[model samples]
Target chain A: MKRVRMRRLKVEKRTNPSAWTVFCISLVSILLAFVVIGFIFLGFGINPLEAYLEIIIETVGNSYGLSQIVWQSIPLLLCGVGLLLAFKTSFWNIGAEGQLLMGATAATWVALFSPLPEPFLIPAAFILGFAGGAVWGLLSTSLRSRFGINEVITTLMMNYIASNIVLYLIHGPWKGETMRGFAYTDQFPESVWLPTIGMSDIHWPTLLLGLFAAVCVFFILNRTRLGYEVKVVGQSPKAARYAGISYFKTIFYVMVISGGLAGLAGAGEVLGVHHMLRHSDQVSLGYGYTAIIVAWLARGNPLIVILTSLLFGAIYVAGDVLQLSFNLPFQIVNVFTGLILFFLISSDTLLKHKLSFRKGE
Target chain B: MKKAVLFALCLVFLLTGAIGLQAQDKLKVGFIYVGPIGDMGWTHAHEVARRIVEDTFPWVETVYQESVPEAKVEGVIDRMVRRERCAVVFTTSFGFWEGTVAAAKKYPDTIFAHCSGFMRAPNLATYMADFYQIYYLNGLMAGALTKSNKVGYVGAFPIPEVKRHINAFTMGVREVNPKAEVHVRWIEAWFDPAKAKEATNSLIDAGCDVFAFTEDSDTVVQVAAENRMPVFGHYSPMYNSAPDYVVSGQLVHWENFYLDFLSKVHAGYYTSKNLENVDYWDLLKEGSVEVGAKFGMPVNPKWKSRLGKTYDLVMERIAQMSDFQMVFDPFTGPIYSRKGAVVVPVGVRANYGHLLSLEYAVKGVVGSWPGEPK
Candidate 1:
């Protein structure tokens, strides 16, 4: 056999970029995204700067707008932080939307039908919501562990089933008598309603719970033995096996935690915002899907998920503001968010990989 | 580089402030929609009326947000009332009923007119065009044109408003062609274009030669036109989309209602004491709901003379009712459900309350409610 050596340019993985460098890269990428969206605004005969200014002013400047930002953030924060846990362990739980729906369904049932005392009702509803979501999450996780079915497909499919179940319930047995044949349930009693802070829409308990969950998840991922195991399993399953960590146990735990958090969001939304179960589309507005982007943007850091979720929430608030203020189409917000996510991913890739050129030998 | 970015951010803030100060003192009016204005259906009709309101009253400023979900309607209403200082806000969807009511309670000074909804508060009033009248007119045309004796209807949901329209349309169909049947397919969405198109194809396959829909899209009309089937548009005039197929449709002229309501406010008739009872349920007689004659009801040209006669009869009856010379109620006497049960006995007009929550499919209509077996 003739000896032959092939040589080509080799890609190399660089050391993790410094925090400051990463921050700067993110900032620049976001600015670039805005610039791109500004060009799109120009295409529509809108002054890009004026349009951008209107969004910022309407969504973040006034107190009501600020409260709306917070109200919108609660769901994203809960879902995004929960997703961080699952993504960290490489569980690929894409059924957060379905799980969230199940949670909302459970919470609504408790609020509407449960005979628990006023004090117990809210707490009990929250627990049941979490359990409903956890059970839904466990379905896909168990399927993946036992039958080796892909979690992504199962989770995504479950979303449709979950949404249909809600539709069926609203359209059938649980339909409110006074709704006049509309697809909505009766409002949750004021007893079960999450108390708002002052006259604002901010539900303090859920907001505090969301903040606490972020901190708790941050500790769990950084300072716990389970976190170590998750790191090992996510980095390499073979290494997890070598370290005597159970992949099945870790995956199950991560998904339950992830799904429980998302469920909490559903409960908060039902209790705090909607005060009733409506059509499934009206319930979540694709919060689960948006959280996926938030999780990716935060890079699995639970603490960062809070900031990123708030950013995404602001995007939503700003989207509505832009629509009302500038008469810009809703699709503009989608484009803006898409560009930001695209740039963020590209920057992350650029941070991790270094290019090299070598002569052929 | 960081300093430059900071400077740009500060500039953005300053520019926003500068623009924010350019607010006008006009009487601000806000509209909230459950679907996009480009839907060419329910929301589009309302947008057209919004434009008319803007054009008619130079002292009024109109702003609107489209495709707002029911869950977020409260916030949108709050913003419209608080941030935008809208004196009168119109929420143009049934799903927005509760939210509008809640906001009406919170902002007792701001007047709210909720369209296609039944709920009302002290500051909140309800307004809706009597769409069933036009549906009946369209059904008459469908009855004459449907060679297959099978007319298709794509319903959004099994809500009372839609059920009433279906019942009225069926009544018209049976009056003209007793043998004709109306087959209904519920798509469970208000504005899904693809699903509407699919429903149209399925109805065509099921031997329906004429079609009508309550969905918020032009897809059904487009599909019907493409397949050479006659159809009716929902909210706005959709003849431009399906010129060949469109016979006639329910044209909801909200401008008349809006002008009347706003004029009441302008004339100091909208005081808090009287606002609670201000429900404007207008029909063809009030010019709020019209047959699509203005859009040039082509009537298939083949069925023109026959459908034209029926149309003239409907118009004459409407005129008589408007002039208070006649009491011709569409839901009067001899109404029967599909199950062969008498819904409205002879010489008896159906109660308005009963009509509001009509749940059963009337005779000659071929579909059940959401949970019932098809």
Candidate 2:
């Protein structure tokens, strides 16, 4: 009777993680990270206190800045949702960046090369982008299932290959002769662009679309047959197989959904902020990689990806603010981001037990 | 453990602080380089200029970051101004124009100089190398040299900088041989050797014996030399890359202009008024530009004299020149956009406003502008 009571208590405790508690812990961790960032200022011959204040104010102080933050968060949310899907099924899709590139590639090809008219073109671009990403994802899935290769390495490698393919095309066969030596295809026609909501600085369509995706993922994960199988498979593949779940089928489904979401993100980015694909300024920002951290921080919950992506988006914007206003090396921003991701991922320890203090022998 | 980590980090901070403090009295100038200093192209030219500043001015101090992205450049400029307290900050990318403007607006007391941009503020000044005119001369040389009259060009991004270079070269090509058709390939990245080689290969395959490119790597010249084709290079003399094949180059001499600017700023004689009008020309006689230093002997000996006369005539014409202006009106009539639109009239030059905020390609170049779809 006592043993049964203890087991029940353990289960209850395991299921009862308060969101506020996690939020506070993360806040403290971020504050600690800032203290480390302060030391970076001493090297640059600036007051750390003043630099910190400037970063905070510039990133979040006013409406315009806030708008910029929201704009940056859209890609993160889209990518984070994709990350969440793959991670839930134990497939580490590290190629969200590549998937995003391929999506842009397909969308641009449709926008420029295809003769599809008006409303049909915009949807077609998104669909083609999704299909492009799915194809990329399928490559990894097949490699993992058939050859027993690691999906992570294959996916990451594919990103480079896909990017290079697009690079070659834009500069070669697709390039206009009159614009000789310029590395780009023709500009995307205006008729095929995604429509933005009424003069709002933030893209409401993307935000709403992301929210809708989250709801769909939430229902699929918690209320569908596939969701239960994914959970079981992620926890223990041997048990999942015993329970009649085909590993190959599960991997294929997870990758398709994952890549599709990432593709949607690429479409959103080109449609939302950049408008066209400029290969020069695209990759260095690491929006795709940051989404991995966002998904991890949110504990792979589709609903929580929004908050986590925004938090990361805030860091990205604040890092830029800190670098510009403080004259700090942009590398320092990478360091802080790396530290925050490290702490956030490691904080999973809290799910098991509380840290306790003991006397030395 | 915490104390040790903190102490080590603090030591690093102090060391950096000492360096920063030492920079102030020395006429501190911060340069935001867009590529690695080792890149033989764009950033290399700037670094050479920075070195010239250091060599010429004993009191001037320069700090820089190589391989910085456009999105993060604002932070570096901010730090240079507010933290390092640099008297002058030079942002060296067209994309950095907005960031520099924001910085100049926010800190009106500091001087901000941008390369290849048009944004102007009381404290902000714009400057560019004007390589297009020189490239036009090279195009003339290639036009005279090529037996087939098929010229190839390899460029980076399709920004106005690259576009103007190609367009000017094309005009020069047509000036010499109206039948000469220029073939161009753009490798998106600035300094990848493999892509550069591939682009060279593609152009070569397309029957272009004369090659020119705006790439930052030496691979273009190397590939040209290997394939035994005459190639015009961009940024710095490419004699070292390929003495046999390189005929002309558009070199950037940043030192002379950089030294002049720094000396004035250092002496406190620099004003927004003076800086705004400080558009110094990079010409052959000014030690900032040199052309045809590596133009090799042609396979046909009889054709050499004619090429020499053409070169001499071009030199004479450029000698009478003050600035390399865009003569071709891409937006005018008689010009066909790649999309078949009769955009510009034949006679009028594209005005500064349209050229600066160019959103579309003048009918020949394929691809979207800065913010178009795929």
Candidate 3:
């Protein structure tokens, strides 16, 4: 009893982190990111506390600002949820931007040229948008499945072609007669325009659609048999094949769902936000690309994507706030966002392992 | 759980109270830009004017969001009007036309002015400098200085605004040196330096000794300087960037118009109700559009007299307008399209409607439309 044996401690990896540990790690990572960004604020001759306060006051403090945050989050939510499904299946679909554009183009065509009634036109636009995006998504899936081509290259290249198609249409046949030779199409009729809630920019229908999509995706990935097959194929393709899962069919289905979701985002942007098809930059604003970061930060969780997308949306609103209040350049917002993402990814390693001191063996 | 709920409620109250304290009595003026303010080109020019506005009006507070995409302009406008309480908003991009118009309709109490566009409403007024006047002067210098007789123009887009500039420059080139031809290239972007440099090099390879560009960077001037060729700057002065190659270029002076417009707003002469049908297409006569230099011309020392004479002629013609006689109009008659059809007949000066909607290249231009065969 008097001679107590000395015990040795060891650092070891955890097969899985507890929910409480995951939550604490995320909070700590975000706090550490803010501390680092505070140093940047000081370097810019701005008080860190004041800068953060201004961002909060401008973005989430008022109803108008909150509406803007929600407005910006709609596209991100759709794209992020879509990418969540694609990444879950281990199908690297980098053509969300191209798919988004094709969807907007299709929706715009239906809104402007379709002879359908007001009641039918809106639904038809959504359907056509989904079809357009699905086709674009299938292009890369087919190339990957049929020819074993890397999807990253084909998808990235498709973005340019899709953008050029929009440019050609706006500059040629679809150009508005009264636009004075501008590079934009005519506005959609009021009937096709997504009705907003009260006077705010909150397009409730699209917002509800985004929320519904996240729930549906979560159910598909967690509760459905197809989801079980997808997880198996993603984890171990050889085992999935032994279990009689067709790799081709899984890839096709996942790509279709992913592309369809992105296409719906495009339709929302055109019908709900811009009310017309303009330049690719104006329509998407790199939301499709930004969704990649959103999906990764959410760890492929469709439910988590809602919060992550709103976080990014807050960052965008903060950018405008920084410009308006601090008189800072827009690039400062980029640096801030880049720092947050950097810290979040770096802290990911902490979730898998814990450091402990070891006594002499 | 009760403690957590109480803490959340307290935090919300604190945030709302803190936000309420930020209201001020200052008259906020908001600006929306389509490009970065540090581009040293179009946005920079507007930023410079904004500085003047800030310095001139002590009571007015200025706020701006740069690189606001065209589609998102309406949202920014709404934020400015509703959240920031901005009474007057300036959207400084042609692509923001639709958003500005829609915002004007939505916020009838706020005054909206769109730059480089043609749409106007009761609360929405449009303003633009007569850039073609300066481009024509630059063309005169390019025409007189070039030895290869092949000039190059790197345009940003096929829009009517840019098309008019290209046509005017061609007219100036052919006016002095009839043999000089202006070859055109479209980069399809306004601010891509790499593409601008590539386009400039391609034109240089195509035997263009003198160059003019409508892009939003100094890449063309830098490329021409590297090659020891002559070029003209667009939007801002590029003499410091390329001392040897840049002879003369268009320098947009938005300060005069901005000061004038803001003064009117401050004086209560220009408001939402009176702003309808108000379009400020300021020309060289109004001092809104001028030669590059602050007081006089920024003509290169070598060609000062030759270019100075044309500048004097333009000013003289403006003065002579009070007497109802037009002498040195850039779009004056006998203008021919690239297809050999006379677009502006002899003894007829092109009016604002025709110039604003220019669709075809002039006879001396050596490029076709986007879908046309070269």
Q: B1-374, model 3: which lDDT tens digit per residue?
A: 99997996688678656654564566678999999998968899999899888898887878888998887788788777766778889999988887898888899988889997877888888898878877887787788877899999999888888889998888888877899999999988889999999999989999999999999899998999899888887888788887766787887779888888888988889988887777888776666765552225456665555454565654454454323343467888888888887889998999888887778788888975653212
Give candidate 3's whole-model lDDT. Answer: 0.83
Q: Candidate 1 on A1-361: residue-level lDDT in tens? A: 8756666776789797777777888889999999998898888888987787677667776777788888888888999999888888887878889999999999998999987877898998899999999999999989998999999899999999999999999999899887877789987778788999787889878898889999999999899998888888988988999889999999888888889988999999899888889899999999999999988788767898888988998989988887877677777678879999999988877678766776555
Question: What CAPRI-style quality would you assign to candidate 2?
Answer: incorrect
TM-score winner, 2 or 3: 3
Clashes of 3: 1
Model 1 Cα shift for residue B317 (angstroms) = 4.4
Q: What ranges in model 1 sit over 4 Å off?
A: A1-13, A354-361, B1-24, B293-302, B306-326, B371-374
The TM-score obtained by model 1 is: 0.92
TM-score of 2: 0.63
Q: Report the error of model 2 at residue A140, Å.
A: 8.1
lDDT of 2 by residue, A237-290 (tens): 999999999988987888887887777777766655444555524532677788
Clashing pairs in 3: B122-B276
Q: Which candidate is the best by TM-score?
A: 3
Ranking by TM-score: 3, 1, 2
Of all native A–B interface contacts, model 2 reproduces a fraction of 0.02
Per-residue alpha-carbon lDDT of candidate 1 for residues B6-94, written as tens digits (9 for 90 to 100): 99779877775564454446778999988888887788889999999999988788889999988788888887776677888999888
Q: What are the models' TM-scores?
A: 0.92, 0.63, 0.93
